[model samples]
Target: MTRIKNILSVIPLFLIAVLQAQEVEFGEISKEELLEEKYELDPDAEAAVLYRSQNTYLQSSGGGARLITEVHERIKLYSKNGFGHATETIHLYKGKSARETVGKIKAFTYNLVNDKVVKSELDKDQIFENEYSYSYDQVKFTMPNVKEGSVIEFMYRINSPFIWNIDEFRFQRDIPIKRLEAELRTPEGFNFKQTHKGFIFFTPSTEKKMDNRLGMDVVVTRFDLKDIPALKAESYVDNIDNYRSGALFELVSVDIPGTVYKSYSQSWGDVAKTIGSSSDYKNELDKTRSFKNELDPLLQGKTNQLEILKLLFKYVKEQITWNGVDGKSFQNGIKTTLKEKKGNVADINLLLVAMLRYAGIKANPVILSTKDNAIPLFPTLDRLNYVIAHATINGKDYYMDATEEFSDVNLLPIRDYNWGGLLVDNPNKVWKHIGRIAPKKADNMHLLKVVVGADGTIEGSYQSRLTHHSAYQFRERYKEKEEDEFLNDLERKLSNIEISGYEVKNAAGYEGNVTESFTYEMENGADIINDKIYFYPLAFLRKEENPFKLEKREYPIDYGFPFQDRYMVEITLPEGYVVESLPKNIVMNLPDNLGKYKYVIRHMGNKIQLSTIFDINSEIISAVNYLDLKEYYNQVIIKGLEQVVLAKAANGRDTGSTGNK
Candidate 1:
């Protein structure tokens, strides 16, 4: 009898395996194949299916045979008649042994009040293993309660396609979702094309998917087959929403279920305790008992505190590496990270704070969410995502992000230096503001002494000095490549100005301001029309390379850091030719002194000096300032490319002039 029972179990197991394989129709596919397919499902299609039905495990992963937890979504889509759909789902996770005892569950219902999600009520259930005969448990969910409206609205569970350094789960339906436009964010040199409805296929699509920028998997669809005539399509960055909600409208998942589950789900505290409970954690703790003296070398027997502090800041940033993302398991704090040589943002920065404290230096951990995260700090623990160390030396405080490799002791990378950062004073303590980004000032001085021939050919050696932010950005561009490649790339990016010969100086060391002097020979492509040669004056740096490409946006445009840009170009005209028209000298003060722009042109004999300066006084500005900023940029661009006409000298007598000359 036992042998017969074993054979029966084997048959069901084999059949179950077969079903699992068949259900996986939407596995990872090549870009070519993905593009070929007309309709594709989301990566979480498996989860989506579970949410499609009522009495199904909608939000629990612990029950394989029996769904234990679920979220019920109900909506009343009413124009005149009540045509509303209600959906309930139960999510279940089955353990390694399809045992009912191992199952866990939870449930919730979205509540909408006057077209807004007022609250979510979690469901309570009794332990029921009788839901499924095969070692099963269950999660129960009911439909969300909502009022009648011209439009249906609610929030739905969504998993992020991009697994940044940290995982992001979205439940946005604050507004209606229309023509959804989501651009795949990626680093430079990489390009991608859309595949299927919501998926974008990345270039060089590799079989070995390890997740770089090889494109992220996404799922988007309009569930209501009957489209509303008034509803139009729209797009939003970093979020999904409904576009048209006539009067009283709130986005509520009517037919969709929840997207969370339990299957041996590990909690942060649990993971930390388990690890910290072991000898490994103890051994690691012992290793980093105290931070070594990082400032001794800088002192060099002088005992200068300022220099020592600087050295200490530099050492911590260089020696400690930020893992960028917080580990799901690392709750024991910085001690665990110190011994491992690698830790999450919180771990590393907190460790740095500990180190400073150990070294008798005053340092505090500043908690902040990176620009991408954009969580508001309202005294809630949820707002704090990452940490950076702030230290005061000689009565001046400097922000230090130890995780970043390119950041100096006082300077934060533009990427992390967003709007505002909150400095958390340890656990359960008052918060302090670490402030926003620093004012990056770039003073560019270009002195070109060219011996122009009578043929209108400008031959000169140009020395360009870039200071502050400009130099920092310049160093970052060719940081990965060799010297020759860097120079070639730099020249190419500058402009269409043809350089017959060139040289680069002060390009390597990134401590501060960089000065590059290059020998250049180029004809200022000026067309002489009726003795008036119009020089476009696109300049080495033109406005066509404008970076702000934002559209009508809902969120605020954050520059993060303030910056000042100064451009000075001195060009020596040919001995025979004379300057007929130089760009007008213009100076304008920005609104509220947030920034300033100045353009000055001075002609000293045959040489003309053109200077342009734009300075941004503040980093954190309101969105209302965007229009002014945009307008300022527009003017700067027009002025930068403004032409300077040079008339050729009548060659002893009057004759037909050549456009080339």
Candidate 2:
């Protein structure tokens, strides 16, 4: 009896060991619990799981969805015999019971290009397994040769009963799979190279962890070696249909007939359950509210509009920080953003809208996802990503995105003002167009009084003004630098001049227009030689040298917005000197009537006056007018480099008269 009991125990232990060995030998699913859980899901829901789904909607149009299916792909390779060639075929079937539609397959091609497969005369038959046979009558192909790397890129749509863009196709024991095999074709010693830019396989054998472009976790199935050449991989469609196909086929009994994508989407509710509002979020919203309330009265006051704008911008940028995700716009709902303080694009913009509304101002929240970040909204409310506020002041609409740092209250960052925007207003569902590109305006002028001694020495005091967009740029770029450092740097750039005293007028702060005036001293670089003192205008400070540095741009060039710039300089000539030549006044008008420039030079008695004005009427000049605009700017920059020549009186013309004397 003792020996029999021991034998029984040994038998059970041996069975357990065998089972354990099988589980580890190959990546297998052995959980009966998992199987039961899967079976319990709705069959129609299972079918929907296999479909590809996309959302494209907007608040105006409600929202929309798209389902994709049966993607067929064939790749052909032409190669020298030694180089080897291959083709891969993928026929994905999606929809309710998509797997049930996969019919009988006698033969399938693997690692063999169309030419090779045809040459081998492999049977393109259907393999019947569970409730379906895999069929591949359709032939779509990508033929990439060494010569056409940049010119050819191919994509195909396939109906997959499984998940869309799944990392791997898994199969388990259940349905009879006749030939479970895999074939790989690559350069003699080539290995797979992992890349984030393109698709790759993640298999049970993969050991490397990686993060995808979307910041999602993933793994690498294979690594590439330098010596490797082209690569091709194929696996006989897994026929162990019981788990893979059976799971897919079972969907036929259910009413929902979609793809695995639909199934996953349906599970979004479950995901939402895992995320609940936290107390931290509540606290952040309260702080944002308190901050807004504190600033309300100040903003409402009849302060200088520009000063108010600047202050408002500073306050908003400082008050709230972005959580660094897109889609925070109003479409996601502002209440959620107000509650979270750190919402996506829509959320933050909504908060801006709420603040403006609370301040008793007419503000509309404009909705749009940045170009690269979200898909273009289809017919419905979809793909909206970010938001900005549209405020109306004195019958003028101003677009503002406080989320962008350094942007003034009414100014929209170039990134936020793309092509079109939907302004959210209850009575009006109109799509408002963002104006043309902003114009860049910058101008600086210096006037100096100089005394030239008999020995050709000189000294002078100078006054100057740097105005318009140029002023704003200089300030922003140097905001971090000390005031003395900034002025010192300017003095250094005008090094030929000796500085006596300097004052930055209208530089206390930036108010819509940046205007600065300063005083300085300088020595003349030229002296009278036989009364013909030759002098050249300093071109280093020339306003037109290189205003537009970009050689070419895919998008429009923008200054801060509509802009105007003016610079005037006056220089008191020496006592015995008379102006010889002066730069001619030049004007450039944009081809499409976009803008104009005025260059003026005036000579009055012993004084030289130089004034320049650049004005851009509007932003969105049509692309059709690019050629004319380009030509116009070319002329302006060229003429801006022209010099003003000066000549002095003859040696005896003014006897014993020092320029200062």
Candidate 3:
């Protein structure tokens, strides 16, 4: 009986082994994986990560230590959406006093053909490097013979001279990561601090192994993460990288017995003090005598802090042009930039700080990470990317970054609106938020009127009013693009319409409402069948698409700023016609009065007027409110598509009956 029972269990065990064969393995492309058409776990994914590995540690060289991180990845492309681009790129950072570089790389592409594996190795000549600036460079290589059902793999190592530059290991990406492993080993003289972001939880396997590197006793730490899902991006969010699943290891302190002891990753106050003490920043603050002469003429005997501040701010903005880099330390002194009139972000903004101090407005330099850059999650002077001036007017702090030519005083360029900034004060240091004051509002208003003829052809007029952030965007677009190009875009968008002409108000100013008016004619925007005509009441003023498509969202839905969009349209009926069907008007409201939507349709003697008011009074909505926001917009889109139907009277002629639609 016992032998029989053992034999029964053997059959089940055999089936388990066969099922596990579908799992991933590095450098081993099974026929099942190559033949597979889709990943059952995520049907929408075009490509998937089979495996990823990272091993970062300190390698001793010539009596000094350099940080080395080795990396390997295996990816499978399932469709053309994933196969079009298969280039591998690595970013290398270099500093004045420290250096970092990438080592030789090995990569290959594999495809299954006629039940056999075919291999294509990446050529040595295909590798190229691009140096972005004096501080950074990138190396790139494209995989060879990549196609759908291809398995591509690459491995490389990077060496860095700065210990604090230890990078974070991201477990999640645009595609799912099946298995990710990372290991770190350092000498006893080094210590580190770790941070974890995103929703996934990973329990690391820890073990101590004896090793000797850099002429010192070292212990290795290993971490292995498994089955991390993809962190997909969604609309209405700022820098999804801020909330991705990852682990960061930063060097906290270095203690070399009887030789040197240095500390990093300190308290916020210490971080500010270190920045204030740097000669690059401290010296720029002290040199007020140099720019005082230039400010005297611009100041014009102004006594109010706000007046002096505006004069100096306007002077720097008009006189200098940014070289399109974000930094806190100047490459050249402010005095030189004032004369040369062309400088990087630091050179342009630091001069503003110097001038403000000369005028005795009690201004200081504050560093901010733009929306494109990673949010500064910790108090470290090294990671801050951009600098702006901070002033106290009537005991209120106003932060300004003049890197953008279209910037208007406290109404900063949109990118500078990241959450927090580090304020560098001599003895008293603090973290300043991007908005200590109330947040700004967004306004976009449109008025459209059209008249439909007997045969369903239409003539129309459109006028738009923009304010605040909306005004800034309009001013920027008209300044950048040609007038003909802008009007051509409108003609193409309005669907079966010809733009007769248009005019713009405040084409070159920052401080007022921008107005735009245009005239047009529509060919088939309204449909006519026999003696009946049909049209959506709003015409071109309707919302085109639903911005929120994801069934589920992981982050807060941020509109960036509070906004209100108002659209109104009036449609005049053709001769001898009356409304037969009209969509029921609807009203929707978000909880807590965060948002409201209203649609109204009124039938006048000869015209039908429709108006929709959609407004959100706050900049951000919590995840708990996402479902509501998604449903609200979906209803708006549905209502915007509702049609207005008209029927001809007994005396009317069927002119459109013979015309082809």
Candidate 4:
């Protein structure tokens, strides 16, 4: 009986192998897949990757060697939400002289109709190309005749003249993947260093074989993985791509006979030296004559270094507007940028550095990856995408980005709040870290005065003050909005209350705080049941839902900044009513002072005063503390739901018992 059981298990395994081999081939759709309504492992999944494979190798000729990557992917759509998977986008890199090209594209969508498979071929004319940036382009296409329960497959080849530029091979995505296979082949003349990231790790099977076509030995690395769960997105994550599972190949060295040896991978110091010596970077900074005429006049009578720094900073900000492009090197030279009065991030910030140096202030360029871009896993020049200016004033470093008009010294745009940046001082030839030691802060204060009538109508005057990041965000949102439109939206958000006398102060200024005041009237704001009234003290300001809902999280919670929110409210009870119940005063704090919450209430004659403060001190909470954080939010929600009760008094005297609810 035991032998029979073992043989039965082997038979199932062998059958599964046969089925996988037969069903996963390109351009072939099995009946079982087309008829399947949902994925077995994740029934609610919108789509699933049926199969994915990639082959990367080098092609050498008398002229030179080029890299070629062949990719094939098959996906199944289970519902309308999965229809987005039918559209695919491929990003290509453009070089100064040559660019990567995609060709030999083929795709088809298969649908089950009347128990038969119908295939629709993709039209080549439907494919379109778009310029994404100065260095990148996108090739996009949608599958023809796609619908629910349809399987789509596509195959393409990318040819690159730059052999060292090997893009990362991703094995995980936002949707579940059943099987993934990848192979990389390289000749003996080149060496590569590979790095893997994310929670899932794959050990590639490596081997060596002689290539008869090239008459050389090649190293082949193969990776095969099955059943990879999707990387679920969660709230408060800085960048989802930072936690993706993938492998990146960086060319380490090239050693060929009768040719000089070249090394591509180097330490941070070496990378800094290479950047400093580059003609496009250091040479551009040295060309101070381009802006000498304007900058010299701006700093003519400015003797103090600090004053000169501020003058130059303001001059660049007001002079050149950002063209909404992010780059590390100049797209238009400094001379043209000044002439056009607009340029990319590098153009504006580098010009600031140049002018500061011309004014005899210690300044340098700080290279960093924006929050949208993934954090740099290794020290490669390609990892840095954005640049800002760093200055030393009174023995303290101040980071500044002229692209943001409302930003102040040391208060960079939130996009620049990634891990850390590298300070590139060309003359000194030194590279050091610009740490993110201070957390960005925002403060909000809300004051409400409420009057409850015998008819159960609630009227109140609402005023709020915002500072720091909060003020910046408010200005960015409402700066372009019409007053009537802004009030309409606010009314909808504040529980459809009727609002009037709305006024906002300091909305157009970069200094001080933003203040907003409005009077409101809300119906059904409280429950009335014959001589008794019940209402929440916070009114529309209460937090109804908890943002942290995941049972378990793999990524850290990135709030981007630490913040404090406070509310002070005074409610005037209806005439001839006495307080029957009040919410208990409570205080809650997270471990190690990471966060705090406090609530207090006082019954002062006919007026009830309430105040609450909620503050989070740390910007990032690790995954290990996720449960604690989730529970903390749950408690806050519970407290906000507590109600205040009032009862009719007798003879204008206290008649109802007052106690904590």
TM-score of 3: 0.88
Per-residue lDDT over 442-471 for candidate 1, one digit per residue giving the tens place of the 0 to 100 score: 556666554544554555566777776567
The number of the candidate with the highest lDDT is 4
TM-score of model 4 relative to the true fold?
Answer: 0.92
| lDDT values for all models | 0.44, 0.39, 0.74, 0.82
> Quick one: best TM-score, which candidate?
4
Question: How do the residues 534-638 of candidate 4 rate in per-residue lDDT, one tens digit apiece?
Answer: 888888888878888878888889888889999999998898888888889998888778888898887887888889898888888888888888888888889
TM-scores for the candidates:
0.56, 0.47, 0.88, 0.92
Which window of 10 residues has the lowest lDDT sum in candidate 2?
11-20
Error of 3 at 588 (Å): 1.4
Q: Candidate 1 vs candidate 3: which has greater TM-score? A: 3
Any idea how many clashes model 1 has?
Answer: 38
Lowest-scoring 10 consecutive residues by lDDT in candidate 4? 10-19
Better of 1 and 4 by lDDT: 4
- Sorted by TM-score, highest first, which candidate order results? 4, 3, 1, 2
RMSD of 1: 18.0
Per-residue error at 601 for model 1, in Å? 1.7
Q: Provide the global lDDT of candidate 2 against the true structure.
A: 0.39
